[model samples]
Target chain A: MMQMADRIKLKVLDPGLLTTVQDSGRWGYQAFGVSPGGVMDEYAAELTNLLVGNPPDAALLEITLKGPTLRFEEEGWVALGGADCGATLDGKPVPNWSAFYGRAGSTLILGFVREGCRAYLTCAGGFDVPLVMGSRSTYLRAKIGGFQGRPLQEGDVLEGINLVEARDEPGKIVESIRPERDSDLPLTQSSTITLPPSLIPRYGSPILLRVLLGPQEDMFEPEGVETFFNSPYRISHEADRMGYRLEGPKINHRGKADIVSDALAKGAIQVPGHGMPIVMMADHQTTGGYPKLGTVILADQYLLAQGKPGDEVLFFPCTEEEAIVAWKERRDHLSLVRAYVDRLWRKYA
Target chain B: MSVSENPSVRFLAMGEACVVVEFGNTIDPEVNERVHRLARCLQNLLSRPEATTYQGTFYRQEYRSWSEVARAGIRELVPTYRSLAVYFDPLEVKRQALEAQITQLLQEIDVPEPAGALEAEAGSQREKTFPRQGKTVIIPVCYGGEYGPDLAFVAQHTGLSEEEVVKIHTSRTYRVYMLGFLPGFPYLGGMDERIATPRLETPRTRIPAGSVGIAGTQTGFYPMESPGGWRIIGRTPIKAFDPFSDTPFLLFPGDFVQFKSIGEGEYRKIEESGGRP
Candidate 1:
């Protein structure tokens, strides 16, 4: 087996719609007006890391609707999760929620996403981006963190840490250091990971999300609340990383739909004077002035992030206890995935 | 506000992981004082290793058990004008139980109301007993030049001379209610009524950072280049936010602010010196 290099570089050939580096989230600085920006699909992003045997909070590339074309400069392992982007490695199809080996000069091309709005790509060692304020999530507005605090562009090079085991040599223990790729040397067999069928998320339309009625629920009329719960809202084209603007029945309010500006939490369904509901997302502003009817539960917020324009969404009101139970179940599922992945990697790798 | 020995604060669940504690409906300083106090208390309770050390008696038994879970569950406590939003992890604690415990904890802590608050009506103002404690930071500004693009518009809207407008603005000490909308952007309270100007009919595409502006009764400076409707009156040389700096923010919530007139030469000198203050 040929030794792999300590440092792996990824050269961007085509920067998709918007590919930003993200982790779990930037925490503890919201009080200072900094948003907890991170990957929109937490489940997908974390799953990608798990497939590559990376830490749960490891930094990964968040690819938007359109996908980027990247060329690997060194041998390493990588995994793709989230939206199905019809990925291909060196002209061969790459399946979602699975890890695959990449040799030097191999190109990874992610085409148009057919399912969700965003996808996540994780390298075994994670991206070598500096953490700002305890995270590598890119907050483009402030131009802070992740690859110069901006989206990936063509010609940009990203560094990755070496976090995988060294390739074995036949009947000998050679130096761990990896030699540069040369045309003269015979190539070694590359490793691959096949995820269980159950691990894959089913990307469906007309997603339903659970929500809990809120701090400003009293401001809305009973009919307004009814409309919010009963009707299906369509995601507007104006939606972005900050929030998803929805078009549906107008939510009537008892008074003006403005309040003294207050701190905002992710998933807040804020309705302005115009009555359209805007569900705050990963890159939402720290504070808001509009009255919120409810907040989508943490367990189901990832569904909202995965929705694309024209996607329909129905909100179901759930008790606080139900939300907590749902969140716990999701966490348990993640733990199960971690345990399963570890066993699989040990046996197969 | 007669201390009725009842927890007057209303706790509303924002979601499984977040809850908003509403102290009062309006933006009263007394209510804001209680909000901040509760935030600090909650932070202390969750950050401390032991909950038995808490002296509050209302939920003594609940605190002992809940604090253990809260020590690792609580993520953020954000204090607004009249409320506090507690963001926590649902994996560690149940929401209904945590809400009840939080209500008990708030009831135990005594909030000092304004003098004669009990007899005061909704519109009537009471004597402020809990005055906010903050430092008065003097910000230097260069008004009515290339830096202040909408200075004439503000003057025209207020129907006051340019010099009188500056005098009215610099005279009052405004309170920094909160930093939001943009990083380090202060939501200043207490602008002079005489100089109040309506927001522009159409917001400009770009307002440079540190451009002081007036919108209705509010006055604030832009912390970064953003689209805004506020009528620009002056420009400050102080860099309100710097991501790379040790203290990224120049001003924070509860800080007092005042403006001092400066010339272009002084503005240039301060900008060249890194615009620390």
Candidate 2:
């Protein structure tokens, strides 16, 4: 029998804004009544895990808005990414996105969030966590993951189940490269990490979300579809991990209801009975019964995640091939950034 | 095994990653049985490689491609009442070669018992396959009062007393339909329509975890406390999810869940006794 609790334990003296353990995502069991539970910021979570040399799907703490204070029982290397919640290490502000060494008895306080929503904290070898439906991310709605399928509270401890590491692995801990803290921060220091100049706002001054016609594209009249692409829409207050609601013109259907609870993907803009658009997010349902008007390109999801409720958004139509190409370009860009980071780790540290 | 060709089943491509195949439409025992069998066969094959399988209302396995990009092959086998159109690019796929292999390998499969085929509706099935975990847990839940804040309201909606509402809820067996909206929140099926009611018009920003509720004709349990509008009737002491447990999900799809009413004292006693859900 494995004595799991003894290895790595954390006393969560306080449960920051909203902290949950998450990985890339929960997969392969949605049909069996299991939810696709995982981290909201997949990019930051994966990057932090890779930085610490843990397997891609290893679990980490996802701090939402606020952060929790933890006391670790063992010495380990940890990294934080996404959202600049002012994380303090023994009363000192720690740099974001770099590895930090914490002593066994040291108390780590993560509290950095001014604009962005989520922050990911990854351990040296990844938090030795358990997997539910083959994922380590905590899905609170289902009450099935993290610490006991619940959020961390005062006095809750976490244990690490990683294999013992050699004192000398070829890995280098670089502490200089931090994710830009400014949601409004000017990208002056680094060129590669900065948003591409080509990604500048195109549809006038407001940020209009570009989308592709959905599978049920013919459900709406040509004019309705035209209005969908041309008109400006405001995001409604009802927004969360599931999907986002949009307030716009009441779109009329050409024929009968075009949707019958078929499958739904991230970024699918579906129109329910109320004739309003609902844009599905990262933690969206596998299927929906609403008529889909459009689907946002995968490339633009990052911007959507940063969008707060009541923000002004526009829907522009794009070709499916364009969406596919755009996704590839985004992936290629991510690779370049990772390579640059790899090189910088060796140059510094 | 000299099999000719699969009548209703074939490989399908989902975007750039998963290959999907279906059996029929409608949720009869036959379609479900075949979905389960086919998933096990493909999973046995997938295990030999590193392809990760995503079994939901469909079966999809994500592949690690060049440039570190991930793609999945989606296979949905839920038995809808009619034919399901699976859209994909046929030209991009190695359909001829893959079809040959699928046919040959399918010969090795035993159709299980009664679930032979979807009666050849020109090859169409809506049955999507979800993954099955090993452990089947029987969870104990405490109903009514503080545990379920809206229990009495649900009783009123159902035209029954709170005790009668509890009786009907705990009586019928339920199966997980899908997990969505939140982590570990199971949308279970098989609820009696007698207790069916619409969700609250206004959603609460904070619905406590383990709060079981009924909506329209569906019933489910809330695993975490969050914003929800479901007509909550009661709560359970057992936690459905724990990121720290060896197996984080307490309830798997297809596994049965029954509610057991306990007093306030029993609820705390269960919590104190370390009775995890």
Candidate 3:
């Protein structure tokens, strides 16, 4: 049981490269042309929330290559997942893929990311942001959802739900029911634990992405389609939350490289008249006019989202069945991770 | 006017999670209506309590509601001018089962005849208007001056007077074909060819929200401040997108829009009232 508090605030000391509140995504509004803005790395976001004992879609801060410096105004458990940015708490190093309790007035700082570009910082009870279109993810262009519908800036204060932090006393029986604490009292003890190395994602450059052949495969010449699969494309500097523009071999279209603008999937590889591919991301428009040659499977989008500018990407065609099987395997692995985390919490508590 | 009643339709894989039901190769209002019809049919099917559960698992987990259940399995249906993209959860519903269900629903759908073709058969070239189900929103615009920086350019390109440009733009009631690009941004149809203008060579970095612009044969108002290449001729005072409201978007795919000219004073008044006008 958790005591109710009006606000558990996180004062933003430094709003790094780009810090925005994100969840799984905003759904059911794409038909109305709302962009499905959310966390770039779904695996990391969900894992971060899981470690914090929060719902998979609970809102968390999405820290980009450079992470933000935040100070907790209240005692709460926090977890960092995805890219390892060498996060430090009160001058002490904090490990990724783990959950740690932060005392009130403690400062958390994140340095330059070493490998992956994006990471998620999740609080115990999730960020208490208004749910716009069933999500807390920020869509900057529309100025909707998340913390004021924008990225965190200096002087911004984010409020988190006041939930009871798990504190385990030595040799005490594990209680199934957690007792509610007074709202004015702070959590006495905090425990830290990290997932096994095998569970953590390892990022490497020139990432190989599995793509499913398209809704417009016939629109491209066979050689063009072959070129797309065989060649490596470098992500250009034009990459952002909306999409990534890749510089690669010309994928010459059989006809015009345009279509009646249609619904766009999250990882749609769209080629406009210029013959280069643009991989759609979390903040992609609901529909686009460019002919999409293929789509990076939803399960594999985390790989694309982690790739930074100038990172090389090689695509391989995959069947829809294979993609589904991969997704199911990933989902099963996630369930296993959640169970393992719960068991660890029980052992420590 | 010899358009086939049975158009070539295909169920193409958008990805593992989505399947696009494409009706035609080109844009057509008839195809759009069919897309919407299929979407509606699917919506009606998913809303049923029986359809709420999949493979013995309840779609609604917590705070179970009709809307929550409807979001399970098949999550969203994004209808475009020529196709309907159905995004589903492969974990809940298998692709084959979902495809079969959609095929069954497609068979149940009554494909409406092309309204334009029917009108042509009646010996008239007039546009056949569908039964207006939604209210027609009249957006007041302040054309020319600071609000419309490209009004002179548009008039010169169209070889018409500045006033003629405004008159021609407002004369016809445009059908909202679809919403895309940005939130609440409507892809409108029925812009007169006489006033069709080319997009700017260099797109502006920031076109304010409510900017009425012309690009090729299309005319639409920006629902948010965004960079665009369209030639802006005016600006509207209406809040086309309100993300906080129950109905966040002020317009829909089937809605009708008419732009009415207003002076700068009236525009200020409407702006002050927060789109009350």
Candidate 4:
């Protein structure tokens, strides 16, 4: 158990629309019908953790469209990534994908999202929460894990495990990014380090998601497959962490719509008897009965996660080799950013 | 029978990370057994360092690196009725290499025929031939009245008495095909066709946990309270899933379950005693 003194505290002034503590995901227990609930956008979550120098799997608060208003009880490094939620610290604008130091008693307000659906808020030491089934992610349906197994509410006090010592050295490194700025406070005052513009993902309209034809592609007709790729689908209002119900051209099946329920992989586009496709997301059930037409590639799942309700989505077919190449490219880009951050830390601290 | 004749196996890509090994399309016990056998084999091979040889065939030295990465990459193995979905990290292990390894394993490994198949052919004496039969679990259920709201409906629909419905339901042991829909919810097979009833026209907003129900040829119980369309027949005191417990799930795929009819009094007693029926 960590000592109370070694933890930094944050009080929830106003809980966002849907905010929960999330890590990588809950694995191993899917066989027992457990859903691997986690942050919607893995890319952004990883970047936020990397920005704050937290462990890769460290838990962070995943804020939805409307962001949270939190008061820093102690001084610590914080990073906001994914969606541009118009974050402000002490009434001053704070840039996304940037690591910044927060002074004690400073209020951080994240307003309505202007770019993407979800935003990630990561601190230097990560959120201090008990691990349920080897994860800190909140599975709302089961009411297990996360902060009391539910969304954060007003008056909730969250503790962050203080892994990094708040010495003047690391603070000075953060201040070096904007040394030209004139400030009333001393040299140890708050400063920000932003990620390169090239590395920052652009959230655009009519999101084109690359998909690989499935484990059950034979279940669908050729015309149905054509219809799936040709037509555009709108993310229905029923969308959530479980899945996105797409309202678009009906994907016709050759025979019966139901198959013997099988393991539902993430990003599986299951078209039921009604002919509408429902793309399974982070909190999808372990197994399902509907026939899957295709699965969105691993690299594009984060792009799909950033899409909000009523967002236009177009599916484009890609080969397995193409999917692997796309995944490798994403990995290479992240590695570059990681190396760059490590160099900065090594040089200054 | 030697069981050497291979079933129709297809390696399917469920994106870059997962590979679905489908044994066959139907929900046959033999196919399901193969699925579980393969799952167990992969789990042992991946987790144990010393498990180099499976069924006497030693894996080649060239595939050593692949196995090493597979140990870390292979995140989850989900076994359904006739398929095993292997979720691996694509960055760590390539899908092509993983598929090749699994294909080689399938050819080398020998899965036994289902115990039921052998028993039907050679009578009860041949039960000792197979030692890997799934353990049978007995679940006590309080049928009719408030416990089973649809008991009278089922009785009328099936043209049988309510007592007959209960008797038929408890007669044959059912095999757990898979756990899905909800945590610890068992999708049981081998329900009597006579008692097969259609799902409700309107699904109940809240079906109490432990409420057993029948839908078409399927019969299962709700592990947790949620809105469902299955016809409610009875309620059980025992919890199918307890998140906080060491053994979170009460049932797993390939397990056998037998429903025992009990009175409402016994249900209350078990309910009071922490559902130890």
Candidate of highest DockQ: 4
Ranking by lDDT: 4, 3, 1, 2
Candidate 4, residues A27-68, lDDT tens digits: the string is 888877899888888899988877756666889999989999
Which parts of model 4 are misplaced by more than 4 Å? A1-6, A162-191, A346-349, B1-7, B49-69, B111-131, B263-277
**TM-score computed on alpha carbons, candidate 4:** 0.87
For candidate 1, what is the DockQ-based docking class? medium
Clashing pairs in 3: none
Which stretches of model 1 miss by more than 4 angstroms?
A1-4, A162-191, B1-7, B41-69, B96-132
lDDT of 2: 0.59
Number of the top lDDT candidate: 4
Interface RMSDs of all predictions?
Answer: 1.4, 6.0, 1.1, 1.1
Q: What CAPRI-style quality would you assign to candidate 2?
A: incorrect
Output the worst ten-in-a-row residue range by lDDT, candidate 3 chain A: A169-178
By DockQ, the better pick of 1 and 3 is 3
Q: B245 in model 2: Cα distance from truth in Å?
A: 10
Find the 10 residues in a row with the least total lDDT in model 4 chain B: B122-131
Predicted complex 3: CAPRI docking category? medium
